[model samples]
Target: MSPGDGNDDDLYGGTGQTRTRLPDGGQGDMYGGAARRPARSSSRSLITVVGVVVLLVAAIAFANRGNSSSDDGDAKKPDTSPTAPTGTKAVTSGFAHDKQGAQSAAANYAVQLGSAEMFNKAQRDRILQEVITPSRVTGFEDTLDKAYSPEFNTNVGLNKDGSSPQGYTFVSRTTPIGTKATGYSASTANVAVWCSGLLGMAGENSKNPVTNSWFTISMKLEWTGGDWKIVTHSQKDGPAPVPGDERASSSDEIANAVEGYGGFTYAR
Candidate 1:
């Protein structure tokens, strides 16, 4: 059930959807026949939950560290590049034509393909144009068009039109932990990106509250059109770790955190 596999049921297991895990709090199951209202809690509880989340984030950073080597000191050097691409464009391009470039391209492609924007046809097409090889765009589009059907949209707690409900916000984002490039050549490369993602609906009564998952995306990239573009890609679950003891946040708290935080642009 890799991304672009065209099996709607496996969408989340593959790449685009999030598998909802029922928490201690009574949260509804969006696809489990009937929906239940989320349990309510006070802001103090939310603040405590936020503190737990921060700790979990720190743990993730620690887990993602590359293995030590003779160049461990070099690895510890801070990245000088901006956290994001320096432009007003929605997606960045002009990657270097090398292994590092291919890794960067693959990481960014994973983010775009895993984004909530992929649910909307127009935005999806635009993203494909930017990140996918031109010749493969139609094939990818055809696959995703079927994969992101109305029923599929509803199952993920979005409108049939792939829009968020009036009071709900759909969340889909991918953060690359690291990337490795192998089978590199002047014109092509293979890159695998270790990623952590957040996906689901965020609202007071969201049937599917946002949850996180870890997976790796393997991409085949070609240096085409003066930039590295995805020829094809697939995803497999984990490299996931055991759950931490952190308390799950309320739907409102999760929603607020997503809105307050911005994402980074990953590179090797």
Candidate 2:
């Protein structure tokens, strides 16, 4: 199916978090704005990093692959990896002071940065406060305020004010598949998180049906205020896997699943 239409490049990208190099050797617009609107193709291509979703797909495939020995030879084993669920909201603190800590921070920050809440002004401000480096919070807030404008909201299937319509739910969630620390020092680090994402409006006859995307987010973090806080971040499209043959769910099913399932606080 179509991944919806229009200039919602910011909706998928850093959500005003990533920086890009412009044609004139200027910095990229974090999200789509008038300054960047005329360069739609180039800007969107630079910033439209896809988001993520649930991990049950592989598990379900393993369980239902059948018992035939012929198929068994090719059947993959189920992933039995242990998870590091925090049992807390994504707005967490007190991460360790090492490379692992940087990975953990990147994972959690990806969740908040890519959430539906980021589309709303108040919630967005609150998120910036929690995840952004103290010295950079004001700058992030200013850039994002203009990034998530009413026009941007409407383009992405939300109301002009960035709220879901009465009967629909706007979904924008990110799930980190894994994280890696690329650079590390005593007080600074760079990490990348491979993630899967889900976005769109879920409801009957919804033009923007919830869809999946794959992307990687790269973040530069610093040990600030006793915890890792984002200094800057950027995203790129993939290392995506091949699509499976499973039938897509109905809009109602997608909506129900989103409501029923709560998000996680990720760790390295």
Candidate 3:
């Protein structure tokens, strides 16, 4: 049941010792022609019955302990390896070279779009302008600005300035699983990013708890303004796996880690 609700006492009902007195009637007389058979069991029979019971109890205890240990151990293991890319490089690279550069670009862009800074209007605008087509950049910035308004920030427990409260850490980190270019042309590409993200806050007395989500983000990329710029992008939920054994990191640790690690600019 619901993790850590087991007890040894419940397993072996009361104490190991049980006193069952047989009735002094027909069954007793059938064995010894007396209204009551001797109150005492023969030493041999008593030992035999006790031995059988002890063996049964021991077997049950061993089985329960083994099962419990297995469950506990399984809960602590982490699943960190990335999953295989569903689409082949050949399928993705119709126009561009099916080499490291395209892969790297897709990966880097995915990370940038998935960063925590994307939730801030000013930061998001700068990122969008840097990573999107010049023609579509204004529209993207406007849409995102509207999405991350004061009410949305408040709902996510961020201050009016979009900063986390002191001692609290907001987490929004994405790990790319794989990149696929669905359609590629000489100057444009449609890239799909399969990713996993940790989103929410972690801290003592924090209202929000850290949570994981899996999603696929697809972007229509145009080679404009000296780089690949996203013209359009969309996201859909996961092909996620079962949870793993890593101990939950505290809010302060999560915050420190995020600040310490610098994000990448991908090209492949």
Candidate 4:
């Protein structure tokens, strides 16, 4: 399907709340002036996170599979794990304080929770179930549902039911640039994720053309089950650099680009 947009955020009709571009603390531009740029973790939260990780282990399948046996060669498959240390399960557990697992989890969760799919009820529920502490899932659902109200949906040029506009593709993606731990403990860690995002709608004759943005997502993480889970989260604008004199892409081009390019899975 094709996409539509108007970089100016035409969907909100200028309300500037839908698709969340809510004002965050930072120095960067959204559409005009400003610089462009772009969490803590806890314990009961940890248990819940680890528990959820157990449920998703089979689904993620990132664990390293031992190399296949060879008939003549004896060259063992060198370490193939990406971004994980020795003896630690790949992306399933081992989110200890010193290992930076909490930081990685925060980076990955930022991508999932900030995705366009989070606007949909089913996907949102699943995400909350996986990344948020068990005790908070139901509450987060109710709170977030209210946050993405029907009016907010309409402002983003969607139907009141949160369905995409006909022939249009809405985009909301987040990419983590880096992570830093402000605090750590046996069961809790506080980390920061610097991020950039793409938001708005795509297609011909679209009012809100897709636009790029930068921000920071602050997450209060808890040590649940064993891994890190979000206890609270907040956002702020970017520490953006001055804009260059580059011409912006056409709406059609932007739409095509979004449709053609797939997003990354891991954040770090």
Candidate 5:
């Protein structure tokens, strides 16, 4: 549930933090019911398995042959007409005008603040300058600089200087599940973003493994110079669901997923 003042009443309830509980070892690897070992297979059983595999392979090939002609990507193209404007710029001030736009602004800002870029001084400064209001930039920079101290860096498996550790890829990302405008006006807006996040070091046999978390961040946005700019923000524990018993992917898989998938430029 959202961690607001019961703003989105239909969806929220009492909350500190809620998590979907997965099995101890892994979520994906959990076995339902009894665990049983397969019996030794005879030559005939082996032959049967091979036959099944061949049929499955043939079916997969047939499916792939038809997929190219069936262009799902084209069907999923977003509407870019004026009525439903998809903001072209990653961030442009003086553009967002409604509650939807305010939600979009909060979502994008959440992504930027929780990004891996925020760990680096230069990139963090750029993001602050772009996403935050002018009045808050100096204070935000000072607070963040102190919070991302050398000890904090070491704890998160980064170098003392806030750089990614050599031979290791650091991962930090926040993905908004959905957003709500708790309050809105032409000059001011309050938005809450429900988010799922991941943070940790991704490396083969790394000591610090990646972790997933859920939280809600509420931003008080003000119209300054035109676009929505963050004035203040706060986060609270989530309304998590019970985790499933599924096996967690390997470190290599995690790293590959992080590297291969590009993040979206969020819009309402």
Candidate 6:
């Protein structure tokens, strides 16, 4: 269809074409020979443009109001420096002498508990004996032994000796976000460790793939055998964020990287 044909509907007004009589009074041509529209006065056009700009600005401001509220609400205000510890005075006072020491102990203990060594029976038993309460150490060892059985290792693509297969590299590493003492006494404290971890195998044709996990590990700690030891511990999933852009490393590279890296003894 030809644009603006008389047969076509006119979106703005009447017929697509208009006729105007000539001043001489003869038959007038359609559109008066491409009739020109009445020119808008400069003042009127300026007013129209100003009105449109005002409406656009108002609409943009309204749309941004909600965004401004969110920005203001989501931002945390800066905390004023504290004069001294204020809450739970009794619990704080009981462990006052050992606050720093306890935090350091819990952080280091968390790293060890989440290490790959926990998958090996001998190494695990030794760790438990060193880091767990005397009364609960045996029970914890037995439970962990049951948990890290041959079947479990096989499920994770690990050999019976708790080693990764020839071509597959098992990656299990925990990064601690922070640690807090929820309950503290002269002899006992409940420490919670927030952590993110990477676990699984990275290898061509590998059945298991590396995945990230966020979890909070809570440990019931006791001052036993002259040092802090874990009596019990539990884990729950996270406050996780969206994944980022990073290429996955190959199995051999992952294995070598883990071998080359050494774990740290954390302190707060």
RMSD of each: 11.0, 14.0, 27.0, 13.0, 16.3, 31.7
Q: What TM-scores do the predictions have?
A: 0.71, 0.70, 0.59, 0.66, 0.67, 0.60
**How well does candidate 2 score on lDDT at residue 113?**
72
Per-residue lDDT of candidate 6, residues 70-186 (tens digit)? 232222322121111111110111122364556656655555555555666775666656666677666665545555668756755679777778766565555668888888888
Sort every candidate by lDDT, greatest first.
Answer: 2, 1, 5, 4, 6, 3
- Writing each residue's lDDT as its tens digit, candidate 4 over 1-268 gives 0001211112111211212233333223223323331111121111112111101000111232221222223222322221112222223234444537788777777766666656567766777777777776766666555556687567656688867788776666666788988887867777777766666656655555455555565666788776678766545555444656566665566656656555543445
Against the true structure, candidate 6 reaches a TM-score of 0.60
Clashes of each: 0, 5, 14, 40, 15, 0
Clash pairs detected, candidate 6: none
Worst 10 residues of 4 by lDDT: 52-61
What are the per-residue Cα lDDT tens digits for candidate 2 across 5-33?
Answer: 22233223434322212233223322222
- Model 3 residue 259 lDDT score: 54
TM-score of predicted structure 5: 0.67
State candidate 4's TM-score: 0.66
Off by over 4 Å in 3: 1-102, 259-262, 265-268
lDDT of model number 2: 0.56
Judge candidate 5 at residue 162 and give its lDDT: 69
CA-RMSD of model 2 = 14.0
Ten-residue stretch with the least lDDT total in model 6: 53-62
lDDT of 3 by residue, 1-268 (tens): 0001222122111133111222233221122222221222221122111111100000000000111122333223222211111111111112133333344455555555555566556656655555556676665555445545677555555686767777766655556788887887767777776766555554555545445555565666766544565565555545666666466565566556655543322223
Over 92-126, each residue of candidate 1 has an lDDT whose tens digit, in order, gives 47777888878877776776666666667786677
Model 1, 53: alpha-carbon shift in Å?
A: 23
Q: lDDT per model, in order?
A: 0.56, 0.56, 0.43, 0.50, 0.52, 0.44
